[model samples]
Target: MNFLIISKYFYPQNRIASFRINAFAKYIRNAGHSVTVIAEGDHDMDTEWNGCKVSYVKNKIITESYLRDKIKRRKRWTVRRITASLLNRIFLDYNLFWGFRVFKKANKLFKENRYDVVLSSYMPISPHLAALNLQLAGHKFFWIADMRDEMSKHPYFSKKYKSAYIAIYERLFLKNADLVLSVSKPILDDFRKMHSSSNYLEVRNGYDYEEVYDVNFQSKFTMGYIGQFYDKIKPDNWFHAFSELISEGRIPKDSIIKIIGNNMKIKIPDNIINNVFEIESVPHDEAIRISTTEVDVLVMIHPLGRKGVYSGKIFDYLATNKPILALYDPDDVVGDLLRETRAGFTVKESDIEGIKSMILKCYSIWKNREVLPRDWNKIKQCRRFNQTKILLDYLSEHLPNQ
Candidate 1:
């Protein structure tokens, strides 16, 4: 089978969006299938990565350039705000311009080659827009629209100025997809609700478990949090809990909280200021190395009310084989996975006492040099290679004719 993957994010971009599709491309090609990737980049290039053919295409938004130039030249805040708002309403999404460019490129690619399947992943939504255009133009290949995150009903963008208009586009484009893939069950449920006639499946983000690292515990009990906090997924509650734990001396005074990323400014409590450390974002491989060897426990944060969000970092934490301290809604899929894998504890953001207790428990295990028992069998299933196999098996079973 020949696979054409269209994603706005791909290899060499140290982002969560790039990992899943990168894994898919590699493993699918390793399975003796031809895989070609069309990815967004600063410049166009035709190259091969991980045994898969790749075409990196440059993408630009005209309105964004115009807005920036106008704002810079005029220094008129009011005009800039109004113009941005008007443009947002007109475009519905900033990526629409890039989407059209991708559509044109995809059309040309289709004419030049025969593809058995086209898998388009989303975040900026340009890839899906391109694939949707191909479908509407009467292409007969099996199309899989992979949503790493939601679009129209995304929690962060739910109240955006053009959400309704975005929803209309989402429906029209996705309804034509032969199959819709999402990262979680709740997200697939939402898609099923929105497009009842379309087929939906869950293809989760996973870690590269094949890359192993030696575990070297930090001298002081350390807890590390990677990636930026977005929307309601702030670390304020966790910070408060840690402060209380330190004040009560429930945890060692030398215990450290290392935040690894270009996170938003956080007001550290006076008591815990000395205990907290911040590190700038590192390469993805280095981040994994730090997670595995430097930190005693890995921290994961999900918004209290959000469901179906398993931050891509969680899988990496799991691969580290270290205990996880996830501050998330106890009823969400994240909590469910943690419980099933016995990877770590899950405490709701509002449960300060619960959070403190979990912290102390993890601290105790580290202080005692005790290793937590994990479901290695279940953990193995979450590896990127295994996840890709599952996706391929599902595709084979469900779309056998293709």
Candidate 2:
């Protein structure tokens, strides 16, 4: 089978969004299927990765550059916010110009190649917009619309009118998609409610790498968190718990809390500032190595009240096979996953005492060099290769014979 994947995010991007489609393309190609990727890039270039071809398309309008420059010039926040809001109301997404370019490239490619499947993932929504354009133009293929996050019903939406307006486009895309794929079951269920389509599937994000490096735990009990904090997700509670633990002498004064790739301004308590080290973002591979080998505990933060959001970082943490300390509502899906895999402890973000207890538990495990029991079979099922197989199996059974 030949596949054409349209996504703004792809390999070499060093983003969590890139990992899913990158894994799919690599594993699909390894399975003896031809894979072609069309992705957003700074420059238009052709490249190859793991036997798959990729075409990077540059945006013509460069709206992002303009907005970035405006910020650099210290534009008024209120003015910029108003202007952005107005533009968003008109365009739905800032990538409209890029979406047009992608559609043109994809349309040209479709004319020359007999693609068995056209899979497009979304966050910026440009790729899906491009794919939808091709479908609207009468191009035929098994369209798989992968929603790593929700669209119209996204929790981030502050304006009901805007969400309602976006729903019109969402319905149109859903109606055209042969299959709708999401990373969460609840997200897929929500999509089903909007479209009344039975062609939806939950393809959870999985870890791509299997090679676990030898554990080189730090001398002091160390906790590590990778990636940025956004939308309701914050590290305030975790920091508070850590501060309390230090004050009570439950953990060593030298214990470290290292955060990588967090650009946001975190309010670390004055007492723990010496213990908390915030490192600038590193490459994805290096981040994985550090998470797998260096840190004694990996921290995961999912905001309360946000259903069906499993930050892609969790799977990477899972791949490390380290004890995870997830701070969110314990009743959420992430908590369930942690329990099912026996990989970590989940504590509610608001429960400071619970957080302190879990932290102590992880510290004890590290101090004793004890390996926590893990369900290797269940963990293996979350591997990218296996996840790709699940996708392939479904496509083989459901895709129209060509």
Candidate 3:
């Protein structure tokens, strides 16, 4: 099968969409499909990547200036990300033509090749619009639309009221797609409610075991959180919970709390700074190794957001099979997965006291048990490889090469 993956971002972007597309594309190629990825070739870029054919289209507008740096850093030094975010939101239109250029290239590819399927992942819903363009050009290839996070239904954008028009465009474009894929069941369900007749599937974000299982366990009781840090989801409650244990001397002063990813934007409270271990952004493999081997307990912390919004890290946490202390909204997707797997404990985001109790109890459980609860079968089920296998079966059944 000849598959064309249309995504705005791919490998090295350090984003959820990029990671999923990169992994899936590689897996699809490994499964004997010829895969080509069309993406934004902004700035100095390469034309191909590891077994996959690649094409790059230049962004119509590029902004790199002192003013941009000032805007980017404003959030780090102060509680001003929201302000920079609003200004940045206003400037997105300047690059609208980038999507159209890629769309044109995708259309040309469809016309020239006997493509079996066209998969477009979104955040920039431009890819879906691109797929729609190809379909309208008399090419009826199976159009698979991937949604990492909902467009209009996203808690951040829905509250901002910034991109209502684009959201409407996304819904209309997605409705016409041959099939839709989402990371969570609730997200897929939400789309189903919006478009009753459309077919949708859940292909969750997952862990790469090879990357995680290599690291030697560094310490016995390290509690760590990785991934982007945001002001809205600051670790205030997290610190408050740990503070209780610290004050009670239940948790040793030498025990570590490792934080990876973007911590510059959200300040870590000074009280816990002595025990905090900060590592700047590293490659995905390195981060994964750090999560599973270096950290004793994996922490899944999220802000109290609207229903169905779960951190992409939940699957990764499960893969480690480390005892998990998931701090999330009781009604969100993370809470749902915790219940389904029975692999971890969930403390409501607002319940500091309950979180402390869970933490202390987890410590007690760890001290008493000879081995950790590393459920290998349940963990394997949530991985990207298995998820991609399911996707492959779907493509073979619904969009087989003629």
Candidate 4:
């Protein structure tokens, strides 16, 4: 079978969305299916990766620098705001020409060799729009649209006002897709309610075991959080908990506490400074190398309303076989996974006491020179290959069983 995977981001992009697409393409190819990934990348950067072919789609407009320059050139703040708004309206999900370029490429690809399935993965929604374009152009392939983040429930964009226009594209993609999959069940449920006619599935972001690398275990009792941080997901509870522990003398003064990648941007209280360290963001491979081996405990921070979000980092942390201190919903999707794998502890976003308990507990174990014994039997189910196999089987079942 021939498959075309359309995603704005792909392998080497180092994002959660990219992990899923990269895994899908690699495993599908390994499963004896010919796979081609079409992603936003360097112009003419077509290459074979992990047993699959990759084609790049260059954006003619709406790049970060281009947008910044356009906005900066506007003298009036009001004019800048208006120009940005217009840009968003003109581009499909702020990716001007991405959809059109993909459509043209996909049209040609279909004309040359008809694909058994065309998987469109999204955050920007441009790839899905490309699939829609192909369908409208009368090139009907079995279209499967993968939603990394449920745009309908986007936090920043108000559904009633700001993203009303975005809703149109969302509805069209859902209505036209033969099957739609989201990374979590909550997202799947939301989509089912919105588009009952569309078949929905839960496709989680799994960690690639093949990419797992070794790192020498350090002696220091270290807790590391790898990934970008923003206002929505600051480890406030973790900080407060650590502060309390320090005051109580539970956590050693030499204990390592680091937040790698983007700055937390939250005001870090001076009390925790003795334990604090920050590393600039590294690429995905480097991050895994650091977190899986060096960090004694992995810290995962969940923002408000993350019930359905089983973060991609959790899978990586699980692969490490290290204890996780999840600052998340105690009973949410991520918390459930932690219990299932026997991976680590979960403290709610607001539970300072709970966070403190987990911190103290993990530190004791780390200090003892012991690692968390994970249930590999249960963990294997969440492996990238295994996850992709299930998805492919479903896709095969949906196809005419020849």
Best by TM-score: 2
Whole-model lDDT, candidate 4? 0.79
- Global local distance difference test of model 2: 0.84
Q: Which candidate ranks first by lDDT, i.e. highest?
A: 2
The lDDT of model 3 is 0.73
Candidate 4 C-alpha lDDT tens digits along 1-402 = 889999887877767878889889988999899999888875757788988888887775543334434434543355534555576766535564667888888888889887878999877877888888888889867889999887757775654665676777889988999999888888888888888999988878888755332334567778899886765788777888888888888888677887877533556778878678888767788888888777888999986575598878898888886788898887789888888878898888788887888898998887776666677788878888888888888977878452
What lDDT does the true structure give each of the candidates? 0.82, 0.84, 0.73, 0.79
Instruction: Give a tens-digit lDDT track for model 1, residues 274-331.
Output: 9989997788988987888889999988766656989899888887878999999888
Question: TM-score for model 3?
Answer: 0.87
Model 1 lDDT, full chain set: 0.82
Q: Please give the lDDT score at residue 343 for candidate 4.
A: 86
Over 4 Å off, model 2: 61-86, 211-214, 400-402
Model 1 per-residue lDDT at 270: 92
TM-score of each: 0.91, 0.93, 0.87, 0.90
TM value for model 1 = 0.91
Residue 393 Cα positional deviation in candidate 2, in Å, after optimal superposition: 0.4
Candidate 4, residue 384: lDDT: 87
